[model samples]
Target: MNAVPFRRIGFDIARDVLGKPDILLLDVRDPASFERGHIARAENASPINLGRFLTETPKEKPVLIYCYHGNSSQAYAKAFSESGFGEVYSLDGGYEGWATANARAAAAAPRLSETLKAFLIAQGFPPDDVNAVGKNQMTPLMQAAHLGPAALVAELLAAGARVDAMNSDGSQPLWLACVGDDPEIVALVIKAGADLEHKNVNGSTALMYAASASKAKALMALLEAGADLTYENDGFSALDMAGSRECLDLLRAAQRRLKAAS
Candidate 1:
């Protein structure tokens, strides 16, 4: 059987794929090096058991395979491909190469905005705390929504922040944006996979809060994303919380849209 030549991806591609919940990565390096710190969501599978792994690995999805160095596993890529695995790749220089490249990026990373940087510092965060999930289980994305500005939210997202991160209170970035009543921020969070039906500690969804505040724009944004207006948290649906006729109108329109879609 003719083996397909493997493509070697760099750290950037690897980092991008880390955001995907379904992507599988196999680190063929030894167990000791893996425990120190490996790529996010990467699983260890050494060259010693290459045949066993190849036999069991799902051939449907693409698998990024790597070792400490590229030498040992380069041939496994060919072996996997010959064994009917659809897509297989080897990291060019391996984990060592990835570590060196990441170090350079870390060293060269630019300074963030003075105000937001100061806020993070005041929160007792280290220099690398931009996207770090703190002990409070709060991500910078959630913090930015509580603060303000498209800038802070954008910066954190660029720094690998998870948009749908829920705080200890179960309040996601979307909930914060709704509380801020910023329509643009609401849209941005929605695009980032903000949970429309997520309930906070008070058992209230973003739509319920928006309805309470009579924020028609924010309410409409959530509604358009298939948010359930009739979905009750505690004893009230968003429509029931709507104090004004406009809020009720928004809820009715959302109901119409949902009905149409289904």
Candidate 2:
């Protein structure tokens, strides 16, 4: 059976649909509010991001949308539906409504596991430091950047995980993104205000990591973002770390341009 489009679902239904892997949850709210908080794994809808979502998201994936008071979601739902999406839903009361409903449910909800709390303590985090990280201080955002569907990275960034939080060894999330080799995630971090030239303990910049990992797209994104090719990590410039011929060519070409412009 074909699923209905622009269906407004209450909290109960919304909750169930959220667990589905194929569902695309979108929060159609402003960036600041999204940074404050929103549904887990939910992508924030901004003008530019919405265009990308509409372009890239598969039409078959069911779309679940919510907004501040729920009214705006219906309009967004209509747009998604008209754009040929198969299943699109709007939260009945929007985020505010969902919050109210969720609060009511949590009142009787089972207590959260102390196992996680214990694990956090063992990992060297202070008892109240609820930020997900181990003794190494690699936040969830860092892990997701290094390995992701790219959506999780976006969700974490929207939910205000510090984009530039470095690990014990001083590896930034942007560096991990280069290891992951996803240009899209690199761009996402860049948009989230990652310092392109911020170096680690060894002074390796994101560009250096990208070159070492060997992918034209990731390296290209950093180069296009104006990453400093001159900055050497432990005296190893990105040119020295170039793993792909394409990246090498890009570095050389970008270098010549820099010289000409200077």
Candidate 3:
């Protein structure tokens, strides 16, 4: 039997991921098509390897599958979901919808890397204006950390923008990134030196936010980056407000690290 291309969701693959951070994008299109252009953070999976993709996929995570036309992939989605992949969704219109939404009519020339760099420089960025813009108390860096391209975030960091710089409510870009469920973006900010210990208005740490949202990957990443376990928000440490056993376990592990360090 041939594989399914489309499932139940109402849009193409790129739009699906663009709308939500928690959704994992599984592009089943051909390698050439995928290499030409694809959504950010999307992974390639040939329809022929259906069983392999299904086995590797996490049950706890939501899966959004798609292909070139939304036809063959549709059948595959149903079969896989019934086989036990709960929360499986397919791109309704397939790559056709994606093309209609994103493809330009004619071939547009790609910008040279040097030109792009100069454009960014002309914008007065990367530590020059990023921090100056934040002097008004509005965190442009935090806003950039929310979405992709990450150019602004880079600019701010180069400009010496505080990685631990907090918003009016004490929420740093790292904390906001976690709350937004952007593990990739969160990782970038942390790599740029985002302070895990910084708290928000409620004194909630990024770890606490990841715990409340059941974001296992985010939670683990925060812990590995050395987020403080004993740090309390308002009055509760992350463990005090953790929603599940997994979260509690993470806090316990963090506690052990603290004891060992001491």
Candidate 4:
């Protein structure tokens, strides 16, 4: 018998699949079990009718299959894979496992909300002392920059967080944003007046970070923002750190343009 490729689904995976618009959840259990309690939007297609159901259902969408204790689902998942379904999953512990995990998450819901609220408040408020550091010696602005959430970065900046504040390792917010490779977040910090030329402990700048991370869009954004290409750290310029061929070509062309202009 040929092996069929199928993923083993856990509660986390099932929950993620539920949110996708193009997902098909299959409950292979008997009618009574499905009617008692099944995942929202799941379809009941018992083993006997599975062939007919497969003929009607779209194969391109992800299919998540589950039975009483997951054993039956594995057989169904293999069948679907053999029939050329691109994405097939067998729920590891079946519907029973999903129900138990959901209950646990529900019980912790209030604590999760409070923790989220505290995080939001910390980003929105100004630091009591501008130089104050957290556990890792990272100020609020530095931490926000590393996360690459444009809204949080904006909130921190608006709260009077210093754009040039350095972490313990001497990395600035712009450098951290470049490391995250998010052009929008990088642009946000730039618009908020972050220093494009500021160097970290190793003397590397934000442009170097973008190049090293192979972030072509971010590298382009840095170039358009007028980052100095000639600047070098330990004798290695942004051109040297350009990890992708596309970024290397862009850096070389930009360097030529800068030289010509000078």
The lDDT leader among the candidates is 2
TM-score on alpha carbons, each prediction: 0.53, 0.50, 0.43, 0.50
Greater TM-score among 1 and 3 belongs to 1
Residues 182-227 of candidate 4 have per-residue lDDT tens digits of 7888888899898899877678888988888898888888998999
User: Cα RMSD for candidate 4?
Assistant: 14.4
The per-prediction CA RMSD against the true structure, in angstroms, equals 8.0, 15.4, 14.1, 14.4
Ranking by TM-score: 1, 4, 2, 3
Cα lDDT of model 1 by residue, 150-196, tens digit: 77777766665666555667677888787777777788888877778
**Per-residue lDDT of model 3, residues 53-107, tens digit only:** 6787676556777777777567667766766665677777777676665434212
Of the candidates shown, which would achieve the greatest TM-score relative to the real structure?
1
Candidate 2's error at 33, in angstroms? Answer: 33
Choose 2 or 3, whichever is better by TM-score: 2
For candidate 3, give the lDDT of residue 153: 56
lDDT of 3 at 102: 42
Error of 2 at 58 (Å): 54
* Candidate lDDT (C-alpha), each: 0.72, 0.77, 0.64, 0.75
For model 4, the stretches where C-alpha displacement exceeds 4 angstroms are 1-117, 120-132
Ranking by lDDT: 2, 4, 1, 3
Which is better, 3 or 4, measured by lDDT? 4
